[model samples]
Target: MITIKVPCSSANIGPGFDVVGLSLSIWLTLQVNIVTTTTTTDTTPPPHTLNCNITYEGEGASHVPLAADANLITRTALYVLKCHGQRTFPRTTHVHIVNPIPLGRGLGSSGAAVVAGVLLANSVSKLGLSKDRMMDYCLMIERHPDNVMAAMMGGFVGSYLRELDPADMERKEIPLAEVLPEPAGGINTGLRPPEPPLGIGHYIKFGWAKEVKAVAIIPDFEVSTATAREVLPEVYSKKDMACLSPITGTSGIFNLQRLAVLTTALTRSPPDAELIFQAMQDKVHQPYRKHLIPGLPEILASVTPQSHPGLLGICLSGAGPTILALATHNFEHIAEMIMARFKQEGITCRYELLEPAYEGAQVIES
Candidate 1:
């Protein structure tokens, strides 16, 4: 039996939309057992018969699928195996999942599931793929590097997808249907799925101050990432851009400047609450997403280092209904202020105080 553990993640980090992420303490764990039951003393390779069972508990237990073809983890594992020329799972396989991360709450639930799947395949097949190579498989499924990379590598992380050559770009454009196809009539052995472009993602881990911890003020609701993205405008006017920019600059330049500063600012020993407060301000996505999340503007505008002591910075966690506030002390006080604002908006919320999961994903066998 093998046990795989993966951490949940929060992406965007205020100004760095889709560019930065931080792994939190919550986890998604998978316990897998693969047994061989062969009565015949056959020397040749056994037929690829599918016998897989999955059981899930925690967060989305009522709604999450258990079938191998429908579950994200198993489907992703099968996708990786298919790429390496293997068709089916071992004759007898069982996977038990315990998930704590909330789904559709911008907390990288899907990303963790995908990472767990890749690790599962690597262990069961005895594939000696390096972490970097396993990341390639993850990118193919999740398509976003911020959440997945942070979940896989841990700590405070920044990542980007590399520019592919013309041929590889074409390969990159392969539709999701083709990449993770449903095995309608058992596993398809016809045309092979396109493999991911080599080194398609590159990332670096950033330093985080030991004093800083996160307070996740999560509302009792779900905000789909797709819905949050659709509300954003295709272009920004100069006035709209100027709201976030210190100078008369475009929105892109505004976020870039803060992102660069925020990355290093977080590494400082004591941490400058004032500097981090200004750096965490965003113009890219938050402004448009306020409608999706009630009391968002009030929370960001009212909660400040000056108004509340011990508060470093705060922003929407992912495509959130969950707000993340970074702080050093007075964690409960910080959470109360945000929760009060949310209550005024007729929304009930719960908060979690979490530290960064520095170790990231791990696999253990017994």
Candidate 2:
């Protein structure tokens, strides 16, 4: 028997779309116990005749459909078992899940499952696979690296996949030099992503900060991840992508500035709410996702220093509905203001005050 506790995650932190995330305090606990049993009196249970019993607790457990196709946990578990070269399923296997995070509310419900499934499989099989290997498989399964990192490694995280020189792997600070590798065949192949014969494939970087905390305003209604994704435009101008300087000047949400502010905000013990508020101001996905959340515009407008002094910054957690407020103080006040805004528009909502979970995902026993 093995028990795995994986923290839920919040991703796309404002400006850093698909690149930033944080693990919340809430967790989805999975308990898997493998036992021996046979249905037939002759003791002839077929291959994969595992008595699989799955149970769920907490938010969305009642109504949410648990289709075998959509259950990342079960899928990844089967994959992990396959990876371990385990051909036969346990005769009697009981799997239990307890979730506090809301599904389809942009609170990283799937991310938790991904982490949980991989961890559960690895533990049950006694694979002793490295964390990196687990992460690679998880990314392939979930398609969300930022959320994966937060759930796997915990705390506030900024993650991205990029090609780089092996020599630059240990770069501690800024002033990076890009040195193109010379081809072994002598012919120049021009600049390209590092993969295959060219070099090692793209590697994902996970930067973690354990100090930052957040307040999530989770609404009663849900937003489908696919629906929210479909509404976003397929492309954007480079200037719009980077938020070009000069014209917008100081007020503009420059990528470099946003990145710097976010990293600093997370690293600092007592996060600067005003700085983070400005830092998290994004021109990315939120504008397009507002309509999905009722009274979103009003909620955004409701947070002010005078009204919600504890609120550091607020943005859509991932794709929709649930809004996260990053802060170091006055969590209740910030949550109150957000709930008030939601109530003003007759929207029912609840809020949770959460600190960053630095441990990520771990097994309770060996």
lDDT of 2 at 140: 50
Q: Which tens-of-lDDT digit does each residue in 1-366 have in candidate 1? A: 999999999999999899999999999999999876667454544333345688899999999988776788988888888888887777667899999998888899999999999998898899898889999999998888999999999999999999999989778877887877765755663238778888989999999999999999889899998899899888877655554434844345667778989999999989999999999989889999999998899899999999889999999999998999999999999998889998998989888999999988999999
Residues 247-299 of candidate 2: C-alpha lDDT, one tens digit per residue = 64544446557867777666665666677777887766788888888888777
Off by over 4 Å in 2: 36-43, 46-49, 64-70, 162-212, 242-253
**Backbone clash count, each prediction separately:** 0, 0
Give per-model TM-scores.
Answer: 0.93, 0.80
